[model samples]
Target: MTARRADRAGRALAQGLALALALAVVSPACAAEADPANDYPTEARADYVFACMAANGQTREALHKCACSQDVLATILPYDKYVEAETVLSMRQGVGLTANVFRNAARFDDVVADLRRAQAEAEIRCF
Candidate 1:
């Protein structure tokens, strides 16, 4: 009877471990489906946070604020558009006649404008 009880306990532990492994595998897929920024890769989010903290000032508070800002941006803008706008902004800031194209392109300006509006909203909502 004691041996049988031990065997049952071992089976219970194995079942529990299997359940945990299943949850660990499935939970992220469920979470990704629920998350709005599912299309934004982890590196993109990290880059945004790093840039935001740099602009806002590096501090503990800045970390939360930057994360909040990125979340707000991700909520408002799709990742593709966000990338396009960031690219425009980066090119516009370049120092050369070649950069003039990015600086002067009306479409790029519009994209950057949209990003600015989103950033402003994020500032109000997050910061």
Candidate 2:
């Protein structure tokens, strides 16, 4: 059951990424909006969608909600800052000195707070 669930998650992730990439490519406005602050790459958006959907569940409705959530996140956060915050979060999961840097930093906390707020807003608006 666990293996089947993992496989399903993987397939859903791939489909979400493909859909996000296709949307980014086909939409000129998305490319045009790739400026200094709001420049979320198609890959980044897709990654966000994949992760969100995985957390929410692998249903079709979850995919749509995750996509909407990412759209809200992209509107709220710049690509560079979002990357920085996400990197801090990812690194904080480890048990080494590097992880300590992420885990003990107020800046990291602030960024995460911002992300959480954005996510909350997204949930309200999308879900």
Candidate 3:
């Protein structure tokens, strides 16, 4: 009876450890999924921060504010939509007929407007 009791205890301990290991493996993936802003690539966030710092001034305060702004923007806008707006803006900068198309389209205007709204929100929140 004592030997059987010891065997049961060992089995229980093994089960507990397995459960803990499974949770450890799954927790980070679950967290990443829960966060809407996790879809933004690190490089993209860094680029925004760099541009923001350039505009605001290259100081520690600027770094913090710019990083916060990027986070705020990410929370407000999905990465795909952000990319679409940026592409439209870039096309609008070209000095030709192709640029005119981007500049004149109502569809493009809506896309850029969404980005501008997100940027305004970010600026208000961070700066």
Best by lDDT: 3
TM-scores of the candidates in the order shown: 0.77, 0.69, 0.77
Those runs of model 2 whose alpha carbons end farther than 4 Å from true positions after fitting are 1-38
In model 2, residue pairs whose N, Cα or C atoms come closer than 3 Å (at least 3 residues apart or on different chains), thus clashing, are none
Predictions ranked by lDDT, top down?
Answer: 3, 1, 2
lDDT of 2 by residue, 6-114 (tens): 9999999999999999887878665556644347777888888888888999999999999988888778877777888888888999998999988998989999888
Worst 10 residues of 1 by lDDT: 32-41
> Tens-digit lDDT track for model 1 on 33-107?
898667778899999899999998999899999999888888899999999998888887888997999998798
Q: Candidate 1, which segments miss by more than 4 Å at Cα?
A: 93-98
Per-model CA lDDT versus the true structure:
0.90, 0.85, 0.95
Per-residue lDDT tens digits for candidate 3, residues 3-67, read: 99999999999999999999999986787699988778889999999999999999999999999
Q: Give the per-residue Cα lDDT of candidate 2 at 96.
A: 87
Candidates 1 and 2, the one with greater TM-score: 1
Clashes of each: 0, 0, 0
For candidate 3, the per-residue lDDT at 22 reads: 100
lDDT of 3 at 36: 81
How much is the lDDT of residue 51 in candidate 3? 97
Decoy 1 TM-score against native? 0.77
Pick by TM-score: which candidate is best?
Answer: 1
